[model samples]
Target: MPFKTLLFSKQDTIAVITLNRPPMNALNSKVYKELGKVIDELNEDSSVKVVIVTGAGEKAFAAGADITEMVNLSTTEMHEFCLISQDAYNKFEQLNKPTIAAINGLALGGGCELAMTCDFRLASENARFGQPEINLGIIPGGGGTQRLPRLIGLARAKELLYLGDMIDAVTAEKYGLVNKVVKQSELMNEAMAMAKKLASKPAVAMKVLKNTVNNGVEMNITSATNFETNSFLVTFSSEDRLEGMKALLEKRKPNFSDK
Candidate 1:
């Protein structure tokens, strides 16, 4: 399908979704819907081992939500709109496959929330991030309040949200907001390179690993370990496991079937 606000393409096992609106790709209802569609495709397609989300241009990953639309929204309308966007983000987070957020530039407010939803975050040296929603007399309604704390720490999350200050890429990386920061020119190359590396690994194992790691964080330690152990056992029962073992025995690279 043709996308209105984003570009979706696959290379080998990586699916890249570029937020196509120029300058800073601010989120809109259309953008959210388009993203939701692509996210759904990533979830259902076995060939898609990883997904990379980024903005089209160098200005921003996403500046924030479309505040122009927000001006007209009543409290109820605002809730509905935020829910739509949050639902898309929730879908992205729940995806069994791994996802990497390519923070190309300024990732503020809902933009920051979007990146936090992903499994990993890689930022360009020119990137910036923050939850600057309070300046507008509002709080982030799109999972920021909850996710930021979990990502960094409660104190750090509170400091960022309370002050609504934007931080540089390097600072963000130090605080655990971003995974790594590279030169602007190397941004896409680095993201795709990492995606390719992850794609080369056993796809089914990555899915199971991602699920156990992500879900385990919310559960107690004992339950989480049990869940992970169960996943370990489950993988050994798969065709990919057999191939991985046989390939090791034959002294060759394993070719996974994602089964």
Candidate 2:
């Protein structure tokens, strides 16, 4: 299906989704609706190997939600709106395939939440980030509260959310909010390169590893170890694993039927 607020392309097994509103690309209900639909489509399509998300303009990946529209909603309506946004973003985060958020510029409030929802994040030197909902007498209603604490420590998450102050990309990297900060011109190229490398790997093994890492923190040591043990057994029995081993023995690149 076609999209109104997003532009999607496929290259070298990576599905790139660009937020095309430009000039900050503030997300609204329509953007969330389209995003939810697109994400569902990607999840259903086995042909797509990886997903990359970025904004169209140089000014911001997404400055935040469309505050002008948000201000008009009643409290109940606002809660419902936030729930909708969370559903869409959680879909991106919990996708079986890995996702990368390439922050080209300011990623504040909902925008920051969106990037945090991805499996990994890379930002440009010109990028900035914040959870500035408190500045408006509100708070981050998306997955910010949970995801932020998980990424950085709870103390740092509190400082950023409570202060509602913007931090530079370098600071964000230092605080472990982002994986890396690159030159503005090289951000997408670098992100795509990483995406391509990931796409080349066996799909089920990648997803299983993602689940293991994500679930590890929420589980006890013994439980997490059991999960890892099961995952190890599962991977050993997979066709991809056999193919990978055989390719090593054959001294050739593996042709992953993704079996």
Candidate 3:
């Protein structure tokens, strides 16, 4: 299937989804619809061990939502739009494989919300981040209000939301908004390299590892620990676990079948 608002490609076990609305991949109805479709396909793709998301061109990952298309929307329509957008983003957030947002440029408004959905973010030196919807007399319609504080601290999330100011990649890293910052020229290369490394690991273990953290974080300590213990036992019963332990004793590399 062809996409009207995005570009999708696969490299071995890695799938790359680029927001493709030119210099600024502004989120609009088309983008949201296409993104939902893409994510559905990726979710069903067993061969894809990791997913990397970035924006086309150099100037912006996604400047923001498309205001021109949104300016005249009725309150009811806006509500529906927000739900559609959030649904698509949430699907990507819950994808079984690990996801990395390669933030190459400005990731403001909905872009910032999108990045927070990823397992982690790798930003280029030129990357700038913000939740500037307040500048337009609105607030974040996506998951920013919920996810931002969870990623950073409460105070920092408040500052970004209230002030609606853009922060440089270094500042974003300092605030724990991004994992690392790299040269703009090296962003894709570095993202692909990291994705490939993750791809080579035992897929079942990776899935279980992600599930342990994501599911455990929302529970009380005792409940979370119990969940983790049960998850560990689940993995302990896998063929890959046996192979991994046997390989360690045998002094050989383990070839996991993702079982």
- The most accurate candidate by TM-score is 3
Each model's Cα RMSD: 1.2, 1.3, 0.9
Model 2 C-alpha lDDT per residue in residues 1-259, reported as the tens digit of each score: 6888999899867899999898989999888888888999998888888999999989999999998899889989988898889889888887879899999989999899999989889999999999998989988888888899889999999999899999999999999999999999999999998998999999988888887888787999999999999987877888999999999999999988786
lDDT of 1 at 108: 96
TM-score, structure 2 vs. true: 0.96
Q: After superposing candidate 1 on the true structure, give the runs of residues whose Cα lies further than 4 Å from its correct spot.
A: none
List candidate 3 segments past 4 Å from native. none
Q: What residue pairs are clashing in model 3?
A: none
Backbone clashes in model 2, listed as residue pairs: none
| Per-candidate local distance difference test | 0.90, 0.91, 0.93
Candidate ordering by TM-score (highest first): 3, 1, 2
Q: Report how far off residue 72 is in candidate 3 (Å).
A: 0.5
Assess candidate 2 and give its lDDT.
Answer: 0.91
* Model 3 lDDT per residue over 24-131, tens place: 999998898898898899878899999999999999999889999899999999999999999988998888899999998899999999999999799999999999
Clash tally, candidates in order: 0, 0, 0
Q: Say which prediction, candidate 1 or candidate 2, comes out ahead on TM-score.
A: 1
Candidate 2: worst 10 consecutive residues by lDDT?
208-217
